[model samples]
Target: MATINSSIVIISLPAIFKGIGLNPLEPGNVSYLLWILMGYMLVTAVFVVTFGRLGDIYGRVKIYNIGFIVFTAGSIALALDPYSAGAGAMWLIVWRVVQGVGGAMLFANSTAILTDAFPVNKRGFALGINQVAAIAGSFIGLIVGGLLAVVDWRAVFFVSVPIGIIGTIWSYKSLHEVGTSTKSSVDWPGNITFAVGLTAVLAGITYGIQPYGGMTMGWLNPWVLAAIIGGLALLVVFVMIELRVANPMFNMHLFKIRAFTSGIFAGLLAAIGRGGLQFMLIIWLQGIWLPLHGYSYEDTPLWAGIYLLPITIGFLIAGPLSGALSDRFGARAFATTGLLLNAATFLALLVIPVNFEYWEFALITGLSGIGSGLFSSPNRTAIMNSVPANQRGSASGMAGAALNAGSSLSIGVFFSLMIAGLSSSLPGAMTAGLSQNGVPANIAAQIGQTPPVGSLFAAFLGYNPIESLLGPTGVLGSLSAQNSATLTGQTFFPELLSGPFHDGLVLVFVVAAAMSVIAAVMSITRGSRYVHVEEAVPEKGASVPQPSTRSV
Candidate 1:
C-alpha cells in the first residue's frame, strides 16, 4: 500500500484536479501539480534514513506498525478534503507529505525485518518476493488509479484506508520485536544535515525544470543555483559529521563493503532510468500516441495506464524467479545481464516511432520490465546480505534513499533533456501549423512562445496539448468552425508534434540507455558474492566461496 500510493496520484491527477475545481495547467496552479506529484517522493527521500535509524534504535516492527496507522490516517484526511481550488490542492499536498512520512517508516525497516526473519540461503528468494512487491506496486498503482478514477476521484485515496487498517491490525497482532534493537543515541547533527542537504538539492532539481528568465529551464535561476550549491556543501558537512560522530545516523563504514556499495550504485542508476521511462512513456502515450490513435484527452490518462500493463506483467513473471536463482548462482550474471537487456530495450524504445504499434510497444516495455525485475531482487538481496545484522536497518534505509533519490533525480534530468530537445523545433512547428489552419500569424506566434514544458505537462496530465494550449488564449472561439475543429482535432496536433516530440524522445532515451549500461558495469564489478559475518570472521587464509546450492 505504501509503495502503491507513491505512484497512484500520477494517473489520477486529471480527475483529482477536476474534482478540486482547479485548472492545473494554468501558470499559477502549475506548482500545485508539481508539488502534488513530487511532495510524497521528496518527503520519503528526506525522511527514510532518519526513520530507518529510528527503527534501529527502537524496533523495526514497532515503527512499521505505526507507519500503517499514520498512512491510513493520511489517506482518510486526503479523502475527506473539503476545500476547492488552491485550498483543495494544498489540503491534498499537505496530506500527501504526511503519507510520505508514513511511507518512509515502512520502507526504511521492511527489508531489515525480512533479513532478520529469513535464513541466509533463502534470503534472496525472500527478499526477491519483497522486492517484487516494492517495484511492481509503482506500476500497479497506475492501473488501480485509472480504474478507481472512473468511479470517483476520492476513491484513489480512500482505496488505501481499508487495506491500511487490515495491515496495521495484523502487524500489531502478529509481529513482535524479532531483531535486536540496539540502544543508542540518535545522531542529531548528522540527521539534520543529511535531511536538509538532500532535500535542498532535490528541491532545487525539481524547480530547475520550470521556466525562469524566459528560458526553457530554471538551471540558471539564482535561487536554484543557491539551493543546489548550498545543498552539496551541507552534504560534505554531513559526511564529515558522520565520520567523527560516535553513533552515526548513517554508518560511513558500510561503503567499505564492495557488494553493498556497488549494489547501491547500480540500483540507483537503474531507478533513474526506470523513473524516466515511466514519466516519458506516460507523456508519449497520453500526449502523442493515444491521441493520434483517436482516444479523447480526458480518457487518455486511464488508457495510458492500461497500455503500460505489459511491463508490469513482465516484472511479475521475472522478479521472483531471478531472485530465487541468484541465491544459488550469485548476483553477477543475472544482475549484469538484466541491465544489459534493459539498455537494449531503452534503445529499442528509441528506434520505434513516436506513434508506435501496440504490439511493438508492448514487447519492448515488457522486456524492459523483465530486465528491471531480474535486476531488482538480486541487487537488493546482495545489498542486504553484504551488510552486518546491526546495520541492516541503516543499510536498508540507505538503499531506499538511493532508489527514491534516483527517481527524484530522473524527473529533473529527463524533463530538462526532453524540454531542451523540444525547445529548438516545437515553437516553429506550432506556429506554422496554427497559421496554416487560418489562425492569425500574431496569435500563432504568441502561442508558440509558450514554454515547451507546458505542452509536455498538458500531454502528461492527459490533456490534449493543442486544446490546452489554445484554451487560455480564447482564439479558438474567434476562428471559423472548420478551422477551430481542425485546430482541436486529435490527429492535427499529434501530426504537428511528432517531429519535435521525437527529437526530444531521442535524447531522453539515449541518456536512459547510457545510465543503464553504466549501471550494468557497476553490477558486474561488485566482486564475488559475500555475506557479512558478525561474530565469526572468515579464517585468515580462506578465500571467498562459491554460491550455495541450498534450497529454502
Candidate 2:
C-alpha cells in the first residue's frame, strides 16, 4: 500500500486537479503539481533513517504496526478532502506528507524484519520478493490509478482503505519482533541536522527546476542557492555530529564494509536512472505518442499505464530467479551483470525514435526492467547480510534513504535537463506553428515565450496544451472559430512538440545511460559474497575465530 500510494497519485493527478477545479499546468498551480508529485518522496527520504533507528532502539514490529494505522488515516483524509483549488491541493499535500511518514516507517523496517526471519542462505530470495513488491507496486499503481480515476478521483485514495484496514489488523495479529533490539538514546542533534539539511537540499532542487528571473530554471534564484549550499553545509555538520555521538542515527562505521558501501552507492545510482526513465516514458506516451495515435489527451494517461505492462512483466520474471541464484553464486556477478544490461537497455532507448513502434518500446523497457530487478534484490540482500544482526534496522533504513533520495534527486536533475533541451528549440517552433494557425504574431510570440515547463506539465497532466495556453490569455475567443478549433485539436500541439520533445528525450536518455554505466562499475567493485558472521566464544578459554570480513 505504501509503495502503491507513492505512484498512484501520479497517474491520477489529472483527475485530482480537475476535480479540484485547478489546471496543474497553469502558472499559479505548477508548484502545487510539483509539491504533490515530490513532497511524499522528500518526506520519506528525510525521515526513513530516523524511523529506522527508532525501530532499532524500540522494536521494528511496533513501528511498522503504527505505520499502517497512520497510513490508513491519511488515505481517509485524502479521500475526504473538503476544499477546492489551492486549499484542496494544500489539503492533499499535507495528508500526502502524513502518508509519507507512514511509508518511511514501513520502508525503513520491512527488510530488517525479513532479514531477522530468513536464514542467511534464504535471505536473498526473501528480500527479492519484498523488493519486487515494492518496485512493481509503482508500475501497478499507474494502471490501478488510471482505472480508478475513470470512475472518481477519490476512488484512487479510497481503494487503499479496505486493504490498509485488513493489512493493519493482520500485521498486528501475526507479526512479531525477531531482531535483537539495541537500547540507545536518539541522536537528536544528528537527526535534526540530517532532516533539515536533506529536506532543504531536496526542496531546493525541486524549486530549482522552475523558471525564475526570466531564466529557464531557478538555479540562480537566491533562495535556491542558499538552500542548496546551506543544506550541504548542514549535512557536513550532521556527519561530524554522527561521528562524535555515542548513538548515531546512522552508523557511519558501516561504510568501512565494502559490500555495504558499494552496494548502497550502486543502488542509489540505479534508482536515479530508473526514476528518470519512468517519468520520461510517461511523458513520451501520454504527451506525444498516444495523442498522435488518436487517443484524446484525457485518455492518454490510462493507455500510457496499459502500454507499460511489459516492463512490469519483466521485473516479475527476473527478480526472484536472480535473487535465488545470487544466494549460491554470490551477488557481485549477478548485480554487476544486471547493471550492465540496464545500461545497454538505456542506450537502446536512446537510439529508438520518439514515435517508435510499440513492440520496440516494450522490448527495450522490458529489458531495462529485467536488469533493475536482477540488481535490486541481490544488492539489497548483500547490504543487509554485510551488517551485524543488531544493525539491521539501521542498515535497512540507510538503504531506503538512498533509494528515496536518489528518486527525488532524479526528478530535479532529469526534468531540468529535459526542460533545458526543450527551451532551446520549443519557443521558435511554437511561435511558428501558432502564427501559421492565424494567431496574431505578437500573441503567438508571447505564448511561445512562456517557459517550456508549463507545456511539459500540460503534457504530463494530459491537458490540451493549446487550450490551456490560450484560454487564460483570451486569445482563443478573439480568433476565428475555425482557427480556434484547429488550434485546440488534439494533433496541433503534439505534432509541433514532437521534434523538440525528441531532442529533450535524447539528452535525458543519454544521461540516464551514463549513470547506469557508472552504477554497473560500482556494482562490480562490491567484491564477492561476504556475510558478517558472529562466532560464539568458548568458556574453556579456547581462541575463537574473529569475525572474518574476507570475500567467500
Compared with the true structure, what per-residue lDDT tens digits does model 1 show for residues 1-552?
877887789889999999999999888998999899988988898998888888899989988889998889999999999999999999999999999999999999999999999887888899999988998999999889888887899999999999999999999999877786778999999999999999999999989999998888999999999999999999999999999999999999889878889999999999999999999988888778998888887788788889999999999889999999988988878899889999999899988888788999999999999999889999999998887777888989999998898888888999999999999999999999999998889989998988998988877887766777777778889999999898878778778878998999889999999999999999988877778755544689987554322212
The per-prediction CA RMSD against the true structure, in angstroms, equals: 3.5, 1.4
Candidate 2 residue pairs in backbone clash: none
Off by over 4 Å in 1: 471-474, 536-552
- For model 2, the superposed segments whose C-alpha errors exceed 4 Å read 537-550
User: Lowest lDDT 10-mer window, candidate 1?
Assistant: 543-552
Q: Total clashing residue pairs per candidate?
A: 0, 0
Give the Cα RMSD of candidate 1. 3.5
Candidate 2 structure quality by residue, lDDT tens digits, 44-151:
999998888899999999999988998899899999999999999999999999989999999999999999999888999999999899888888888998888789
Instruction: Indicate the residue-level lDDT of 424 in model 1.
Output: 93
Error of 1 at 521 (Å): 0.9
Output the lDDT of residue 396, model 1: 92
Q: Give the Å shift of residue 315 in candidate 2.
A: 0.7
